[model samples]
Target: MPNRLRRAVAGLIAAVLLTASATTATTANAAPSSGFDNWSCKPSAAHPNPLVLLHGLGGNGPGNYSFLGPFLAAKGYCAFTLAYGQATPAIPVGGTVSIAQSSAEIQAFVQQVRQATGAAKVDIVGHSEGGFQSIYGPKVRGYAGQVGKVVALAPPTHGTEFGGLVSVGDYLGLRPLVDQVLQQFGCPACDELIVGGAAVAKLTTGPIAQPGVAYTVIASRFDALVTPHETSFIREPGVTNKYVQDTCPLDPVGHVGLAFDPTVAQLVANALDPAHASRVVCAFGPPL
Candidate 1:
């Protein structure tokens, strides 16, 4: 009986992970629009805080919210994305940007959105490294209470083994390339999302949560980059955690999929709107 139960549990867990990866295509995270290098747009009453979206390493904000921006605008949310990270002389972005550096960029962008929109706080959504910045970066810089809510789509809250793979790059004589690309971010040796020498762990267990900030983590069990599946969970109190595979049995959102997956996007829209809390099914499994 014990063996049978163990096997069943493992199988169920495997199924969820498989579902997570099947959520969407693994090509590259893309946005619906383009062209925002040193440009600015103002926000109106219907769309407040000038929604800020942060992309991961080597990413441009334009491609970050391709499908999402239009959908959000339709739903009355003023949307915006920013490009960050060290740019190479010949390389175009929408690529890799260090986590710590991008976090600061998020803070500055939030300030800009606030100044433009006249809102005290704004909504922040991040992908990959942007996820860390939205959730933990600003608060670490002493701006915790200023954020109204943080929504992370498949954020590596607990970090990942695949990321650990990249931490080894600098040690193998690619140090100059690493330093030139990363020095702009001023990343310290212990930055978790950077070198993987405890940046993720230190950040995770250190203080992933802050008071007065509404937190929600949207994750997929099929994430190829962040594994063990559960790492995407935000374990802090008062945080509303959502697992797409469990919520929508047919949702085809993996790690990158969650960014544009319509179902997941619908869920994201609901979370951003506090009045519609009942629209979300917060149970562990689909209702019987």
Candidate 2:
């Protein structure tokens, strides 16, 4: 890679680390985000399925769903979040392990939520890597029947190129070197996310979606990470794919901001319960 491109990649990595650190600090000091990890909350008639919120790479459950958790809870849904793919018991970050391992963790959590709530099926709302697992768990990890619906936000359903950086690396035959660097940094999941990688191939070998499960994918046009943005869409018959700009042209929320954007939250609410669907209210400026 050229010196300039190398510097850019290094800078991006630094930003991710800083963001993770700040998120961890915020989570440690503040009270638990509302509507998460409430074991006593039961599924209601209006919303019979408990919601499972899955975070992205280097994200903890509480920090990722701080906005959406409370948003859904206010709508009378029993919501839950869990941190999976932690490299060690001491690591606060998640989604760093292999994709298959993370899928198993999701499967176990789903089973636990079902048993506790006595609900036959649970809905899933996954952001980024979490979004990938939402489909991977059901299709690849034998979690089909246990899930009712999946609402994926900026999910790299087909995989991403990190704005063509991975593609450039491939052209230069530096893919292996890149993988080694990511592995050294404790993010095997990063390798799996590269376009046409082994993990992505396994996930996309057959149909990406399972039968009897409703699927909705929401992407942001301004997402700088999941480049081309269209990769987030699942080209299946029953799956609904949407861009944030489709409903709100002025909204500029990106990959990380998808979790905090209110419009995205409303879109999630609509997907989880189409029977009570309402118009998505648009907002401006930073995600809140």
lDDT score, candidate 1, position 110: 78
In candidate 2 the C-alpha lDDT for residue 242 amounts to: 93
> Of the candidates shown, which would achieve the greatest lDDT relative to the real structure?
2
Alpha-carbon lDDT, every model: 0.58, 0.76
Model 2: which ten-residue window has the lowest total lDDT? 163-172
Candidate 2: TM-score?
0.81
Instruction: Give the candidate number with the greatest TM-score.
Output: 2
- Per-model TM values vs. the true structure: 0.69, 0.81
Tens digit per residue, CA lDDT, model 1, 1-288 = 266753653354345445433321221122222112212444455445557776654444554555555556556566667666544534335334445555676678778767765678777887666676687665567687677778887666776656532221221123455556565644442246532435576566666778887777887766666666677677879689878876776554455445556676677777777675435443232110
Each prediction's RMSD over C-alphas, in Å, is: 10.0, 7.1
lDDT of 2 at 129: 86
Q: What's the distance in Å from true for residue 240, model 2?
A: 0.4
